[model samples]
Each structure stands twice: as structure tokens, then as C-alpha cells.
Target: MPPAIREGSLVFPKVPVLQAAGPLGLCQMVETSILNILGYATLVATNAARHRLAAGWKKKLFEFGARRAQGPDGALTASRYAYLGGFDGTSNVQAAYRHEIPLAGTMAHAFVSSFASFESLKPATSLLGPSFPNAVLAARDSVFKLWHEKNFSQMAKEGELAAFTAYAMTFPDGFLALVDTYNTLSSGIPNFLAVALALFQEGHTPQGIRIDSGDLAYLSREARQQFKECEEAFNFPFSALHIVVSNDLNEAAISALNDEGHEADVFGIGTNVVTCQSQPALGMVYKLVELEGKPCMKLSEDVEKTSLPTAKAAYRLYNKAGIPAIDLIQSASMPPPVCGRQLFCKDLYDDKKRCFFIPKAVEELLVLLIKDGKLLQPLESIEVCRRRCITQLQHFRADHLRLHCPTEYKPTAYATAEVFPHCRHFPEWRKRENCAKQTRKCVHQTLTRNRGEEITYTSQATTNALPFKRIEGSAVACCCRSGETCEPPATRIPTTSERCAGNQTQKPGLAVPHRAMCAACECGQCMPHSRISSVRRGISKNAGTPYPRVRACRSECRNSATMTIGSLIRHAHRRR
Candidate 1:
């Protein structure tokens, strides 16, 4: 998925984003390391993109979080990903050099405090007087002329002025100062105007000023007003100077500033971008979904915990306006969705919520990154990725990207009875059985096993007893007693005898003996006789297999729990 895309818009409940098709040992060895690298890199990149959305596209955003990052490597990674996520530049010199990102920053407060008084300017003045005396003298005279009528010189600090003057003299064309060391409006802005007017007189343009503390919105506006006054009074273009603000800014803070109407042209972000203060960790896990050409699934009592079975493909459907309407997941072998065609889409977890969509465009999101353990193409550069992020965001609706009460970008899976006939629409509670049936269908369709081969169909069973097998040419249906409806596998509760049988662990890689009926011994370990008798009659008539003797167990089945025969088989396979 694109980094600019919102979360929850493209969910893969049972879908796999990364697939490993090599030896099991090699796949297991790389799982943890792969997940760790992908997780944090994605988290910080997404966080930076959110900041960019809040700051707006016209405003400049710089990553100033090297000091707040985890370490040197963390800092480098944050810088690279942040720029790729839409930031314009970074303050980390090393990151800018290594990644070829533009570098942007301003003087710190310490630089302002280093100058004590006018005496401190002697060294800089002696060094620079011969080179540019006329420009310095003109700027000082213009500032003194304003003090006579407005009396602004008394309130301004001489040390800060000396610092600004020295800095302007050293780098007149790129002089951007930090203006909140003493007083932003009363002293800092006034002193900066003096040096700015001097630089203007010398035919050099000063960059701007940065406000690091206090109410940024109000300060920026006031500073802009001061610049306007100087521009009109001195007859220079001081009003055009940029106003950069930085002080623990994040998405929320930037959005608030936008609401309050700030005069800021650039935003310097730090802690929130690098540390991911709002959400420190993204929950990305590694799980096996296929092994030896068989579909694998993880089942849990919580429906959300159940993983989707087998290899799948994801597609993004777009409406007429080119805005993404739905993300569709289907069997990898299924043909891709086509434009101008109405397709049936159902909610992955909710059967009641269904819709028919005719998309203007269909995009296949999963592409082949590696083939035969080698790269299929050269890796994309950071510049290309950053441009892609920006371009894609332009197509989404404004409401979806807003900070508050954003409209939801709905996601629907493309699994219908038409595609997978056995997968009839079912409620959330019955999804386990539906998923099991779908898994069997996926395996059959993908593997294409030969005739006479048996495929095990396991429902929620109490013990590791004989698993129901589907013969190549016959159907395996559940049998119920006369006038008694067969229960759905998910809701069926294990009987006391069945639970007791389940407690006895079976040997690894060995199938437990089939029991047509539990032994009627002193322990009273058995299922209801009616159901057992019905199943025995059904299996014997359909498969023509004789029933085996029942196994007697000593323990009592006092605990009742919900479990699937598929889960039992998985456990036994793991033990092997």
C-alpha cells in the first residue's frame, strides 16, 4: 500500500503482504528480522506523511529530529523515510549529504547569547569593515533614524543586534536568525529588521527569522507586521522575508495553527516525527499462511484473531473521480477486476453489509518484487517514491485527509458464492466454518490433486479421532438423527466423553484410530448414542468403510470448549 494512504482503508484480515516460498528453515530464520525492519520504517514514514498533510502542501516542512531519534542509524533512517513521506528537507547534515536531500535550518539560541554587547562586534567589524563598510554603516544609520521617532532602539538588545550584524556580514545572502532568545516582538524582531535593512542596502537578501517558543501564530503575525512597517519606512522589501516557526510541532499542533491563521511559511518538526510520539509501534506480525502447497489458517475464539487462509491478491478500485472507493482481496488465481463492470463486494467481517460497485479504474496492488530469489527490477529511488506519495495524495478527497472527523475510506473483500460456490454468505459467528470451507476450495483449485486422493475435512471435533475425509468422487456431508437439524460446526459443544478423549495426546505424525461409537464402560465416556449411530450409518453407506473399535480413556471430560478439528490437526503437525 502507498504510504500516503490512510490506515484502516486497506485491511488484510487473512491476506499476506509478504510471502516466503523457500525452505521452511530459511523462511523461519528471516521472519523476525524482516518484520522488525519493515515495521519501524513504515511507522515513521507514515507519521511524517501525516505531518505533511496537516502542514499543507504549500508550506515547507523539514525534519529536525536527529537528536531525538533512537541512535545514529535510527536518525538516518528517519531522515530518509521522512523525506520520502513528503518532507522537503532535513536538518541532519549527514542525512542531507547521504540521501541528497536539501538542507535547511536556522541559528540556535546559543548563538544569540554568545554576543554580550557592542564591544563584541569589534572583532567582526575589524575583519569585515574593509570588505563592506558602506552597507553596514547604511543599515546602522537607518535603524538609528527609526529610534529617534519610535524610540524602538531603547527596548532592543545591543548584543542580539551585534550577533545578527556579525551573522549577516559573514553570510549576507543566507542569513536566517533565531529570534526568540530575549523577546520576540520587543527586541528580537527589531534587531533583525536592522540587520535585514543593512543587508538589503548592500544588494543582498536576508532569508528570514524563526520563532522557537511562545505563541507561534501570534508571534508570526506580529513579526510580519513589524517587517511590513520596516519595508515601508526604509523603502526595502523586508515584508517578503519568510517566517519559520518550530517548537515541538506535530500534526495536531500544525492543524491548530492553520485554524488560528498563522503567517508561517515553513514548519521545522522534531520529536513527534522521529519518535512517533502519538503511536510508537505499528502492530505488524509474521505468520505462515501456506506450506507444501496446502492452505494454512490460524483460528481463535476472537474472530479478528483468525487469519485468512492461502495466497491472495489485493486490488484497489477507484470511483469515477479517480478516488479509491474500495480495496478488494481475492484468490491470487482469480482474474483481476475490470473497469465499467459491476462487481459484487461483501464486507470481510459483516455479511449484512454488501454492495455492488462499477469502478472507473482497477489497480493491482501486489506486484512481483522478487522472482526466483532475485530482484525483478532495479529498486526505486527515494525521489521517485516521494513524488509518487505526493501525486497519489492529490487524487484522494479532502475529507479523507482532514485531521478531524475524516470520512472513512471503505474496504470490501471480493469473495462471493459466484467465485467460490461453497463460500455462501454467513454471519460473523459462523465465519470459522465458512473460512474452513473456503480454505478447502482454495487448496483444491490451486493444487489440483489427482483422482482417488482424499482431502481431510475437519470441523470442530472434541478429540483427535478419525477426521472426516472427502473422497475424490463423493461428497462428505454431516448426518443428524431423525427430525434433529445438524448443528453448524462453530456452535457445537463437545460432550463429556468427547472432551475426555481429547485430553489424551496422540503420537506425532500418526492418525488416531477411528471410533464409530464410544465404549459404554463404567466411566460413561461417550457421545450421545443417537448422533454417533447416525454418523456411523451415514459413513458406512457413503464411503463403504467398516467402523473401528472405540478407545477407552480414564479421565473425565469436565471442561467444555470450542475448537476446530483443523486446529487439532495443526497442533499435531506442529508436534511432528
Candidate 2:
């Protein structure tokens, strides 16, 4: 039976269904996020030692020992890698002044402490700003969480919660406020949500909220519920608020959060990220893997011990359509991809091309944090980054993909799978035999699976952990380039005739998306929960007019197909 509609014809529960599958650009924040975590590979053993190839066992062990020789001194500086990568924004004026990198950070519980006794409040705020003007001043949830009337008055005076939003308006790029510091998913959630409803709260939303303690899944769910609750309580709709993640955040943990419908803006990759609790140091080393004259390579039984015999900088190649095609690592000798995907694709899989070049298209630092401790440029306020991110996501199209189906940074090809540094090494005697066996295994595995689409890049390092050295005189491979451009494979979708069997005069009724959309329909666009204003003062089509009774999506035709990037990708996959 057709599921019966409830409430005599309102949009009903389509909201939850829609939110389940919202926009794609909303998920990918590669440049901003990666920069926040890449700095710490400067020294020493990592939490997890790379066990690359079993064959080069002895040499691999020796190489690992060599790495330890850099010893305890480097460890001190190595520990600061995360900070160098961008996480140490604890009002770290020094780090900011040093690396010429932005010391990105938010406010702490101390922000709330400033409001102590109102007498010292003004000096307190001034001191707070001067104390850490470089850091993005994120306020904590010190204003609310009160059950008393006077507390509410204090909230009004301090506008602590409101101040976060106000601070965003004036200093949009200001460090974010700790939105959920006080019962993040509950009381604090509603107040921030109250700001957005009906209108396209499309501009900058909340600073950032810390999801302190709770079943993140349930907390995210409750967060949505509370927004809905406020909209209902005040009689309107609302968008989502900025949420920062604190407790436990890693790749897997991040996946869980986004999976549970939580879209945290920034992740304070503390404890775990800094500790490298799982896998220790990247074991990155700068060595003369190749010297001026001949082809050099390390022969080892341990795959990780094998190092690519060259030094090269990585490059990003884009298709004609400007989509990221592949990642290329090339030495000074290698000619840049002049025309086509072949050279780019080859460079993408080379062992010497392990390091990824920073992507230019994605949102990145518009201003450097420091230059010789003399603040080279003002750090972009957090709001600037956030808005740039949103705009990039919207305009950049497929540049944003799911984590699982990430826009791959295909490495350079032709680079041998010789281990560089993270793994182990083996004798040439064992390596030849092992290589034969591995090649056999690879071929057998490929044949057995017959999946026809195994993503095989000519191996970079045979194993995960191996000794690494920057190649100073590595003979550069100046391969000839195929003079043609890579193209964004045109995905021809179904024609209207193929989709509907006949030409229609017009699209009638609500867009019956190929799959139902999660965003609320606003002026024909789907606005996620974070983009709408609350019923009180958000944008409205029926502005100044009396509230119109909510009605069913007034479409008579039961058409099932509407256009969307996701559906098109799915359809393309089905055809394949």
C-alpha cells in the first residue's frame, strides 16, 4: 500500500530522509584539513613501526637502527610536527611568529572566566585580544547553561552566545567559539540554532562548537532534533550550525562522525594526532638516494627497506575540465607534462613520486602566517576560510567526493616500487627471488579476482616502513611527453526521451529527485539545515505575508527521475 500521508498534507518526514543524503561539496575540505596535520614528520620513531617487506629483514632492521641514530634531540622538535602542520593554535603567538605558519586555534573555558564580576570585564576582553590576537578568538559556551533568571540576564548582557555570532559578523575570520562547551548537543545547540530559520542563513553561521562528551551519533541526531524543536517552538525552519570535534578524531573516527550525519567543521586532532598513537613517525628522511651519475636503487628483501633512487618534487595534473587527474613526482631532469594524461599518469605512479604536491584549486592559505617571525601577512579570519571553503565546494563540483571515493591524487607511474624509508630492506640475492614471487602473487591475485578494475599503481615502496633519504643527485628521468590533454570523461546522461519516453512541456510539481533530496526546498534549491534562518527572522518568500499553511509537495505527476550529480554517477556505474 502507498504509505499514507499524515497531518492532512504537509511535507511530513521528508526532512530526515533528505538530510541523510545532502550535498557532496559539504564533505571535502582537503587543503585546509591536510595542512592542519602534515607538519610533524620531522624526526624519530613513530608510534607504529612500518613492517614493510619480510625478505629484507636484516637490512631493514639496520636502516631502522640508523633512523634511531638521529636520536633524542630530533624527537623534541619532531613532537612539534602537528603544531607545524597547523593544530597548535592555543594562542601560540610564538609558533605563529616562527614557522611563518598560522597558529590556528579557538578559545578555551578561560574566555568565559573573563566575564567574572563585570567590573573587570572590559579590561578582560581587551587583554584577551591583545594576549592572543594572532589566534582565532573562539569563545567558549560560558554564557548559557543557566536555570536561573539572573543567569539569563547575564547571558543577555554578555551576549556570550550572541557575541559568538556577532563576533563572526565583525571579524568573520575570527577564531571560532566553542559552541558546545556547555552541554554541546543540548542547551547550547538550541540557542545557536535559534539564529537560523526560514531565510537562507546562507552566509557565515556559528563559530565552532566542541562536541565534548556524548554518543556522537546520538548527539548529532539530537542536535538536528533540537534545531527542529526550536523551529517548531518559534514557528519556522533553521539551518545547521558550525560544530568542531574534540574528543577522539582520526580517519576512522572522522568517518564515523560524518557517517552519523555530523558535519564538524574543524577537528582538534589532539592527543591521538600528536601522539601518533597507532603508527608512529612517518620515518621521513632526506637522503642521497641517487647521486649524479648512475641509476641507483636499494635491493632488499624487506619491501619497505627499498628506497626509490631519486629525489623529486610532486605536481598535480588537471584534466581539460580542470578536475584533478593525477599526482606527479618529478626530479629536475623530468620534463613537466606538456600535453597529455600519459606522462601525467606515468608520473602519478612512480615510486619517486610518493609526496603529494599541494593542490592549487582547493581552498588554501591566501596569506602566510609568518615570515621570519614578522607576521608576513594577517592570518585569514576563520570565517574567510569557512566562506571560501563553502564557495569552493559549490563552484568546484566533483572536486568534492566522499571520503571512500575521494578525489584520488594518482601518483607518478614508472617509479619503481622500491622501498624508500618507512619500511625494510633486503639483500639483492633475496630481493630477486622475492620480487619474482611477489610479481607472481600480484599476477595471480589480479587474475583470480578478475575484478578488471584493481587500482594498481606501479608500487611506490614495496613495504610500508623503510629508511628514507632525500635524493640530492638523483638522475632525473626526463621522459618525453605525449602532446595531448587529459579529459574529464564525459558522462552522457539519459536523454529526456530515454528518461521519460516522451517530451514533456515542462517539469510539473515538486522535483521528484532520482533519489529524494535531504535539504529543505527553498526557492527551488535544497538548503541544508545549516543554511536556513529560524522562523523569527530568517529569509522568507512569504515575507511580510501571513504564514501559509504547510501543504504537501503539490505535484500531481508521479515522475521518478530528476537530474543530480549523484544519480548520474550511480547511473553511469550501473551501465558499466
Candidate 3:
């Protein structure tokens, strides 16, 4: 067995942890974990065009696709199968909505192109302004160029450059050109810079330039030169313009071009960034695994192909250095991966456990994601998230990258849990067998088998993984607010058990399903009646899993007191 490694960044799962971010150390640790998870096998986009693509799923050329599915529910199975994988955010709005996700983008440059000039764009911009200030820029880059002067003119007309500056603040300051339509390096930039200089003189600030075509490198150089040369004429920045590099931009190509000090601000990539163009479309199909209440997962030949059974949450453990060290797939009731991390065992009916881990910054991202659809807080704009991605990519370790030879971002989980990124297709060629099963078992019994004859399975964890027993909230990470315990009422106790099971004789202040008998108790005692015994018993409850904190008396009214299993469970349920 490995020595108990001291621990990395540890995060406590909130009933939803996405609301507030973990600490910087915790945040980095989490980010590393998920970056690795997503970086693993990858959620590749197959549809390079029309936001739709052909998937690896088999096509059944049944003389007739489906003349009629059985009566709605009867045929629902086949119907669901047909469109099961061929869905996009737009095509499957229901899916996105249910998952608390928004559909992919609609309206594109094509839509904006229909408008011939800036004047044409006015009505639309005016219509969208109250809600979407950036819509104008996003829709028509060309219209922006032609009427930008007018836009500045409007700002100057409104009052002074301040309004224009303020207006620009809401709008991303970058101004990219469809440089290809006209001369990007030659006439396009020179003419545009002249206009920009004219605007700057009028009090409008030109943010940056975008190069859409023509030997991006050459055009970029030309654009820079032209902008610099015309600075006196336009008063444009020689150093500050962000050149958005688009046109077949991806990690590799960008790296090569970036090495040359290519001039581009932000990338205006479309199909590639949005569509995952390089990866052929194979729909990422998700099913209701153990819906309502049942154990389930797709049983693929590859064991790692499965998922977390039932309702599970994702978390990351950060190293002491504040970098993510692993990605953990845990159940709702599991304890975080602190020293006393709990493991879910079905036989014991563990509510949660840390099922998976990877050496990367992934958890931070997960924490930022919405939980129970209740966001920790309103998130920053997409632009902020995008900027973060760019910033993080710049600092990430290179080895964490596996562009061509795609592989699972290897992670660590419980010895009993199914290992992930297990070469499902090439088992003989691979050799990671910490928890790899050598023999196949009844997939039904384990729900580990897939359509193919393989023992792939979702690892089922116990509820013990969840943070349930803390006095007020989860124990994963504490507010540690003052760095010292605060003074409490004479009745208040410090232990988690005591906190939940307050003084039963006291009034039930809040709805603490945790300590049922103490429903009236507000004093921080493990149990109102048991408070006296607890002092003698000592705090013996384990940290992570929900173990019985208080021993119940045989009599509901409680005359004599000994540990009763029924009382133990009753006290546990009260905390809920």
C-alpha cells in the first residue's frame, strides 16, 4: 500500500460547491483536477459543420427508418435511440435546459452580413441594447468598421468621449476587421487606421485589430506596421492592440505562429473552438443512470468507459502547493479527501466516497460550476471565463497536454473503485491494473457490463462520502474564519456531533433534520439528552461518513440510556 501521502488541496462538497470558490490553494488544486479530467479522452466535437456531425454510433438501415414508433411510450425507446446521440445545443434545447446548460450559439456573421451597412445594423443594436450591449459587435464586424465613426460620432453627440468610453466599456474593446473582404495588410488597415485616428481625435479609443485572412502572418505584420505608421494620423496604439488570430486556429498552429511573435490580439476562431472541428463528431451520449432511484451506467468493454453510479458529485484535491492534484467523483454523502476521507460501501450502504482522482487542476473548475442548478453566485461573463482559459493555458505544464495521442488524464481513486482511462479498445497493449478486473462477472449484478461483452462499470460509492455531520455545514473545508474558536453559549459544544444534536430541552431553533430528538434543542450538544454522556463518552464518531452520533434509549421518552440502533439512526436523520 502507498504510504498515507500527506494530502493536496482538499475541498468540502457543498450540497452544491459551485457557489463560492475554494481558496487560492484550493482553487488551483481543483482547476488542475478537472483540466485533467476534461483533458482526458476529451469531449470531442464531431460536427464540423451545421453544428451537427456524424457519430461513430451504428446506423440500422432497417428498410424503413421507423414508419412508426410504438405508442409514444412504446416507441419512445426507439425514438430516443435515434436522436440519442445526434443532438446539439440548438437541436436539443431540452437536454441543455435540463442539465442547467445553455444551447450552443445561434445567429452568426452570416446573419449579420445580410445587413449591408452600419445604418442597417442600428435598428437591431437599438433593439438589443437594453439586454445585449455586445450583440452589435458580435453580429457585424464589418458594420462596426463602417459605422464605428458614426458610433463615435453618436457618443460625441450624446455628450463627450466619456459616454463613448463608457459604452465601449460594456462592449469588448477589441475591434476586428473582416480584413479578407478588402486589403487586410494593404488598403484595409491603412483606411481603417485613418478612420480610427479620426475617431481617437474625437475622443473614441480604438481597442485593437483583428486579422481574418491573407497569410495571417504577413497581414498581421502589415496591420501592425500600418497602424504604427499612421499613429500620428490616427493616434492609435503601437503596443496595445490585441490581434485576435483566427482562421484555422488551434493549439498547435497557434504555438507555431505565436513563436514568430505574430501580431494578433484575441482569436476569432469559430468552427474549431466552438465545434471541436479536428475531432470527428461522435456524440457525447448521456442516459439517465439510475434515474429516480436505481443503480446504472453504460457497460462498455472498457471498464473505464463507465461513469459514477446514481447522483454523484465531482471534486478535486489540491496539493499543499495550491495546485490541483486529483479529480474525485464522489456521491452526495461522501466526505472530502481530507485525512479522514470516507469511502462508500454498498454492503454498508455508504452514501458517498471519493471515487476518482487525477493529478491535475480539475476540481477548481468543478467548484465553479453550478450545483443543484443553484449557482454559488452569479458568474462573471463568458468573456471572463474565456480570458481565464487563455490565461490558464499559458501557465499549464506541457506534459499535461496530449494533443495527438489522445489518452485519459490518468487519475487516482479508491483501490476498489474502477480505474479510468483504461485502454478499453487495447487492453493487451496497456497495463494499468490497480483495480482492473481480470475476470468478467454478471454485469447485471454489478451493472458493470455494456452492450458489448465487457465488464465496464460505474463505481458505486457510499453516502459516507458526503459532508453531512458538520454542526452547521459540511466539514470538507471550514470557514476557519478567525483562525480561533469563537466564544459560544454555555450550552454550545465544539465537536460536529454536538453541534448538530443541540440541547433537546432547548427550543428547536432551526429545521435540523439531523438531530430529531433535539428538534427543540439549540444548544450545541451532540444530543440534548446525551450531552451528559458524551462528555464521558468522548467524541468517537469518525469524521467523514455519517455514523450515529448519539445512542438512542429503548424508550422513546428516554428513561435509562444505553446505545440503541434505532436512536442512533433517528439522531442521524435529524441532521438532514
By TM-score, rank the candidates, best first.
1, 3, 2
Model 3 lDDT per residue over 1-576, tens place: 001111111122111222123243544456545443222113221111111111111211110111232232312222222222232222134433443323332122343235443333232332114323233233224323544543522221111112222233333233333334433543344434443443444344556555555677667776676556554433446455545445655556655564666665444333343334455333233333344345455666654445544444455555445554454554434444443343321111221222322332334224333544354556454334324433333333334433445433434333223322211211121222232133221111111111222111111111111111123321111111122222222232223333223223211242212222221122111223233234323332432322234423223333322223344545545543
What C-alpha lDDT do the candidate models reach, one value each? 0.65, 0.33, 0.33
Off by over 4 Å in 1: 1-16, 122-134, 147-150, 416-576
- lDDT of prediction 1: 0.65
The prediction achieving the highest lDDT against the true structure is 1
For all predictions, the C-alpha RMSD in Å is 15.4, 27.6, 25.3
True-vs-predicted CA distance for residue 301, candidate 1, Å: 2.6
lDDT of 1 by residue, 447-514 (tens): 10123222222222223111222222222222111111223223222233542222232233433322
| Model 3: worst 10 consecutive residues (lDDT sum) | 1-10
Best model per TM-score:
1
Q: Name model 3 segments beyond 4 Å from true.
A: 1-178, 207-209, 232-239, 242-245, 280-300, 306-314, 330-335, 339-398, 402-408, 415-576
What does candidate 2's lDDT look like per residue over 398-501, in tens digits? 43333345454334432323422221222211122123222211110100012222211111112211221111222111111121111222222222232211
TM-score for each candidate, following the candidate numbering: 0.70, 0.35, 0.37
